[model samples]
Target: MTSSDPHAPHCHNVPGDKSAVQPDKKRLVSRLNRIEGQVRGIARMVDEDRYCVDILTQLGAIRAALDGVAMQLLENHANGCVAKAIGAGNGEDAIAELMDVVRKLKS
Candidate 1:
């Protein structure tokens, strides 16, 4: 799971206390559950033989919703983990990590 890119910055610093990352986990799980429901609803639509255009529209909505959730998680990571890393003198590494994710998202 580790990136081998030489230019990729790495973080070996973890929160001294695990509780610091708990909220991110909780929010991620909650968002994923909502996405799961959306997926199941789409499946039901298919079973009901919904119109192709309607199904495609719903799929687009699901994608946008998932992207919204992703943005929220990224914001949280920036404010929490990245901020902490910067405060601890690892700002370059943190920024690099964020940039890498942004690049991945773009692709």
Candidate 2:
């Protein structure tokens, strides 16, 4: 049976090619590293009997940081991978995939 879900992953038989972000990859990695540290800090706070409000604030910051990362990734994917695929005459597939991603993001 075939699934109608557009967000479903499937094997496309295409060779995996590396796509790079327009911005510095090191900077992105650094941001992610900092987020990871924040997570660890939150864990330590929990263990150390920190206040609930402070923990909640840190969690909110983590969520915002994660959202920022997601936006950066989406922008990079659009400009690099989708654009390249469209330029190669596979825009329909790329657009469909992008739509699926957008739908999932909305959900």
Candidate 3:
């Protein structure tokens, strides 16, 4: 049976070409590497029984860093993938997918 949900079986619009050209691959990788290091640092802090407040602060920083990465990725999607889909007359699905991710990011 068909469902209204974009994620429903038979309604999914996964792109055939999974590898979209990423102009900022290097920058994104660099940021992710730093975030990974920060995560490891937080793990160490937890193991050392660090102050709760300090650990909380570090957690907040990591969330912000992750949000920054999300924003960059969203921008890249809008400028590259979404734009291409629009040009190809498949913008409706593209935009729906974009909005879905946007709602997720806001949460």
Candidate 4:
């Protein structure tokens, strides 16, 4: 499913171009900013000798946040690059590439 929000991830360029997909640039930047802050907080926690469980919990959160980012990018790719390729009469190749990407993501 694609997001309707203009701030959602998507490419502003013409479809089928070699350029990278950029869903909402601002949203991505914001997410990365938060993730960076989380990393710094984790570092501080470690330096302060915080509880092992607390640190582990924060680590898990970080991993989940990163996964969310990946999912957004994947969605953008499918909606932009893959869809454009299919429309450009390269559906078979695009599907194959997308499958490979899914496999890698799963692994």
Candidate 5:
């Protein structure tokens, strides 16, 4: 998905070429792995018949952690892809793509 927020500034302005933006794919993957572990821990808690409130708390934490990952990714996209596109005179498209992403996140 994409966005259409033309006036919304990104973290960094990059070229339109996505290949030019060097993303820390390894770091992202590692974070995701940790989140997976959290999920497994929650499952184990359930099997142990943990308190409902405790399980719910853990679930909330997991959601927050996932949101953190999403924010990081969004920052990277803004600094890399969105920035590049705007610099390359494709700002409209970039903004539209970002808006689409924001919409999905909100939903």
Candidate 6:
């Protein structure tokens, strides 16, 4: 699941370590950059005492955008990391870990 692509999302279970490299990292990072900007804008709106409804609307958009990113990463994890785990006969643990995260995301 680990990729040599420098821009990829490398995630690792090791303490203080990064692991698997998810594809399309540049796009993912771009999306996250936009989300960060939106957050900043929302903060500015709050400072300016903008209307509650307008702020709430932006907040909703932010939530949706974050959800999109989460789903993308989730899919990549399944297709890459989980798939690898399954091939290695460690699918049970991988699947359990996946479901745990899925449950957390639902909440």
Question: Which of the numbered candidates is closest to the native, going by highest lDDT?
Answer: 6
Report the candidate with higher lDDT, 2 versus 5.
5
Native-referenced Cα lDDT, model 3:
0.77
lDDT of 5 at 40: 100
Give lDDT tens digits, candidate 3, residues 1-107. 12222222222235673555456677789999999999999999999999999999999999999999888878777766676667668999889989999998897
Highest TM-score scorer = 6
lDDT for every model? 0.73, 0.72, 0.77, 0.78, 0.75, 0.82
Q: Write the per-residue lDDT of candidate 6 for residues 13-72, one digit (tens) a residue.
A: 443663876678878899999999999999999999999999999999999999999999
Inter-residue clash pairs, candidate 1 = none
Query: Alpha-carbon error at 19 in model 1, in Å?
Result: 8.6
Worst 10 residues of 5 by lDDT: 1-10
- Reference-based TM-score of each model: 0.72, 0.77, 0.84, 0.78, 0.74, 0.85
lDDT of 4 by residue, 32-95 (tens): 9999999999999999999999999999999999989888888777877676666667778878
lDDT of 5 by residue, 1-107 (tens): 22343322233443453342225666778989999999999999999999999999999999999999888777777766676677678889889988999999987
lDDT value, residue 104 of candidate 4: 92
Residues 1-107, candidate 1: write the lDDT tens digits: 22332222233466464323434466668888988999999999999999989999999999998898768767766766676688788889889988999898877
Ranking by TM-score: 6, 3, 4, 2, 5, 1
Looking at model 6, residue 94 earns an lDDT score of 84
Model 6, 105: alpha-carbon shift in Å? Answer: 0.3
Candidate 2 segments exceeding 4 Å error: 1-23
| Superposition TM-score, candidate 3 onto the true structure | 0.84
Better candidate by lDDT, 5 or 6: 6
For candidate 5, the TM-score is 0.74
